[model samples]
Target: MADLVTEIRERALALGFDAFGIAPAEARPDLGDKLAAALAAGWHGDMDWMAETAERRASPKALWPEARSIIMLGINYGPDSDPMAMLARKSTGNISVYARNRDYHDIIKGRLKEVAGLLSRRTGAEVKVFVDTAPVMEKPLAQAAGLGWQGKHTVLVSRQFGSWLFLGAIFTLAELPVSEPMAESCGSCRRCLDICPTNAFPAPFQLDARRCLAYLNIEHKGPIPAEFRKAMGNRIYGCDDCLAVCPWNKFASETREAKLFAREDLREPPLSELLALDDAGFRALFAGSPIKRIGHGRFLRNALIAAGNSGDAALLPAVEARLGDGDPLVRGAAVWALAQLADGERVRRGAEAHAGGERDADVKAEWAAVLPEVV
Candidate 1:
């Protein structure tokens, strides 16, 4: 069994995985209680799927009854430049490091299958694979497998890779030797918590996704909450403040996987260019990237918020153009963004031309909020 584990580990490294380890499928029995508490507190916000998949997500055994051992693999996607610095370039949009390249699910899933196939052929064990899309609770499982420990910010932190690992898991019927679990090592470091623009962390090792800009800009389907708008800064797609500030990142290096590196156009795309994206243009630009999944309307909504926070009066024309967008979500956000860059007279003229025909209550409310005198 030890020899087989060694062989598997070698194969994983050869296939480009930077970290590898095994854990008993049921290693984290405490997950169910933790999940229930998080769900009960409404910390997950609009991500209702976390609550819906709670039972199966609680344990690998519950997810796959035949599974006896799990392999956790990580690929380092560390950025070559500091993502935090991009936040200050207010005319451009800031994308989270993870989404700046090709979608990781597309990259990691095939590698996971190849590794799982190797394990099955050696031990004649049935196998299953999962990426972030699955309700696998991968961060905790990665800690159980000794890839890293959950940092105070609740993201897995590796001594070697920091918070930059893209995690994937493989479950198999073979009872491989489990690796020793890593101990929490974030002593007195509050950089991640303090750097959050929206105070997403309720306490150490706890996250309230509702307050997280990454969740608001990505998973969230509606307009971002008003309170978080300015703090959202120029982050149109996702925020990397917490992940980029980790002291553990000192030991990390830029990723060797070329596919994971940020594409030149996406690194700090001009908000003006992004604002001009129509559905067709958006699809063509982000064809193989993860940002495409959010769809055109949501993309515009996010860009409009960034425009509102930009304080660049130059974006006024682009902001006004969206007042008649097909999606009310986009139109409403445009109203707020225009209000930020334009005077009441200009806002009133926009409301006069666009607000009268607006039927959506949300868009009307937006106009009313900005045009209180007219209303």
Candidate 2:
């Protein structure tokens, strides 16, 4: 059994996986408590799926009672440059490093499937595979399989790979020997906590997703809660401020997968160009990328927030044009952006023109809300 496992690890490395391990598939009693606490606090924000799939994610045995061993795999997507650098260029959008290229779900799923097939053929073990899409508790399972520790940021932190790994898991009926779990090695560092633009971390190893920029920009729909908009800065997609600051990243290596590297067009894309995108243009730009999932309305909503913060005055035309956008979400965001860049008289004129036809309560409130702050 040990020899076969060794052979599997070698094959995984050959197939582009940087880390691999196995552990017993049993009920994780502690996960239930942590998940319950997070949900009770409403830290998951609009990601209600976390609550809907709680039971299955809480227990591996509940998910697959037939499985005796769980295999965790890691593939590095470490950035070639500091992702934070883009923040300095405020006229451009700062997207998370992970979304700068092809969607990882598409890339890692194929690799995981290939490795799972090899192991099944070798040992005749019945197997199932999963990527990020499932209800599986991958971070905890990966830690149990000896890949790495769950850091204070609530992401897996490896001594060799840092916080830059994308995890996948395989479940098999074979009772493979388990590896020793990796111990938490985050001494007393609070860099990940201190550097947050929104202070999303409530405590070490705990996150308030409601206050997280990534959550507001990605999973969140409709106009962003006004309080978080200023703090959001120029981030148009997911934020990577916390991940890029980790000390463990010193030991990390650049990804060997060309598909995972940053695409030149996506890396700090011009906010002006992004504002010009209609639904068809948005789809064309992000066709093969993960950013497409949020769709154009949400994408424009985020871009409008960045436009508000830009203070460029040049973006006023774009913001004004979006006031009549078919999507209410886009119009609300545009009202806020116009208020930020347009003079008081221009803002009032915009309210007169755009506010009359607007039926959405949220859009009407944005126009009214600006008067107290700017008028």
Candidate 3:
């Protein structure tokens, strides 16, 4: 069993996984209660799937009855440059480091299957694989497997890889030797909590997804709640404040996988280019990226919010063009953007022409709320 575990670890490393560890399927007995408490507090925001998968998500055994041991793997995707610095370039969009390249789920899952296949062939054990798509509580499981510990901001922080690791898992019927769990090492540190633009972290190690830019800009379906627009700044796709601010990242290095490196266009795409994207253009641009999951309307909605915050008069025309967008969500964001960038006459004219024809209550509300101020 020890020899087999050693062979599997070497195989995983050869295949490009940066971190590997094993844990018993029942290693995290505390997850269910923790999940219940967070769900009860409504911290998950519009991601109702967290509640839907709670039972299966909280338990590896529940997810697969035959699973006796679990293997956790991680790929380091540390950025070559400071992600926070992108926020200053308000005319550009700040995509999170993880999404700057190809979708990690697609990259990690196939490699995980290869490692799982090796284990199954050696031991004749049934196996299952999961990435972020499944309800697999991967961070806690990764901590349990000694790859890292959950940091103050609730993201897994590796001593070697820092907060830049992308985690995946392989579950097996074979009872492989479990690795010792990592101890929390973030004593007297609150950089991640302090750096959050929207105060998403209510306390150390706890997050309210409702206020999280990552959740708001990505998972959220409706218009961004008004209060967070300015704070959202130029972060069009996802927020990296918490992860990038971690001190542990000082020890981290950039990703070894060429496919995981930030694409030249995605690193700091001009907000002007992103704002001009139609559905087909958005599809072609983000074809292999996780950003495409949000679709063009929401992507434009986020860009419009960034434009409103940009204070750049140059984006006024792009913002105004979105006023006639087919999607009310996009049109409403454009209204808010116009209020921020355009003068009173331009905004008033927009309201006079479009507010009357606008059928969406939310768009009407946007006009009503801003028209009083502009006038």
Candidate 4:
């Protein structure tokens, strides 16, 4: 059994995973209770799937009854530069480091499948692998596997690799000996909690996805709520403030995966250039990038919010051009941008022209809503 575990760990490292561990496939008794509390508090927000797969997600045994052991892996993709610096550069679109290169879902899934195939051949063990796309409770599972503890930010923070790990899991019918679970090392540290722009953390180790900029910019569809827009600053994709402030990050090695390297173009894209993208243009710009999955409408909505917060009056022309955009989401975001860029008079005049022709109820309310704030 020790030989099998040693072999699996060695193969994971050779395959580009920075860390590896194993956990029993038994159901975590506390996971289901914590999940129920979070759902009851509405912290899961608009991600309805969390509620839908509650039973399966909380229990590995429930997810795969035959699974007797689980293997956990981490890929370190730490940034070469300070991710927080981009926030002050309001003219540029701040894309999270993870999305600046190849979509990790594709990259990690391919690697997991490769390793799973090898393991199945070696041990004749039935195995299944997963990245983030599934309902797996990867953070807790990874902790139980001795990979890392869940930091106050609710992300896995490895003592060896820090906050910059992308996690994946494999379920196998073989009962490999379990590794000792990682101990909590976040004693007397609150940098992650203090750094949140939207006050997303209700307490240490808890997050409200409804107020999270990462959630708003990515998973969320339609117009962003007014309260979170300005706090979002120039971030057009996701937020990383909490992760960057972690002291554990110093131990993280630079990403070895060429596919995960930050793309020069996405590092700090000019907000004006990002605003120029129409539907076809958006698709072309983000092709093969995870940003493409959001589609043009939602992407444009985020770009427009960044434009409004940009404080660049020069962006007014680009903001106005979207008033008549085909998508209501884009148009609503544009209206908000206009209210921010232009003064009360210009915004009112622009609203009068578009309000009559604009058919979407949300767009109409958007123009109606912003008028009072500027006035």
Per-residue alpha-carbon lDDT of candidate 1 for residues 1-375, written as tens digits (9 for 90 to 100): 899999999999988899999999989999999999999999999998999999999988899988899999999998888898988899999988998888899989999999999999999999999998888999999999999999988999999989999999999999899999998999999999999989999999999999999999999998788899999999988888888999989777743455467899999899999999999999999998899999999999999999999999999999999999999999999999999999878988999999888899888888888986554
Off by over 4 Å in 3: 254-259, 372-375
- lDDT of each prediction vs. the true structure? 0.92, 0.89, 0.92, 0.88
Query: Measured by TM-score, how close is model 1 to the native structure?
Result: 0.98
Off by over 4 Å in 1: 254-259
Cα lDDT over the full model 2? 0.89
Worst 10 residues of 4 by lDDT: 252-261
The local distance difference test score of model 3 is 0.92
TM-score each candidate.
Answer: 0.98, 0.96, 0.98, 0.96
Clashing pairs in 2: none
Residue 168 shift from truth in candidate 2, angstroms? 0.5
Model 4, residue 11: distance off in Å is 1.8
lDDT at 133 for candidate 2? 91
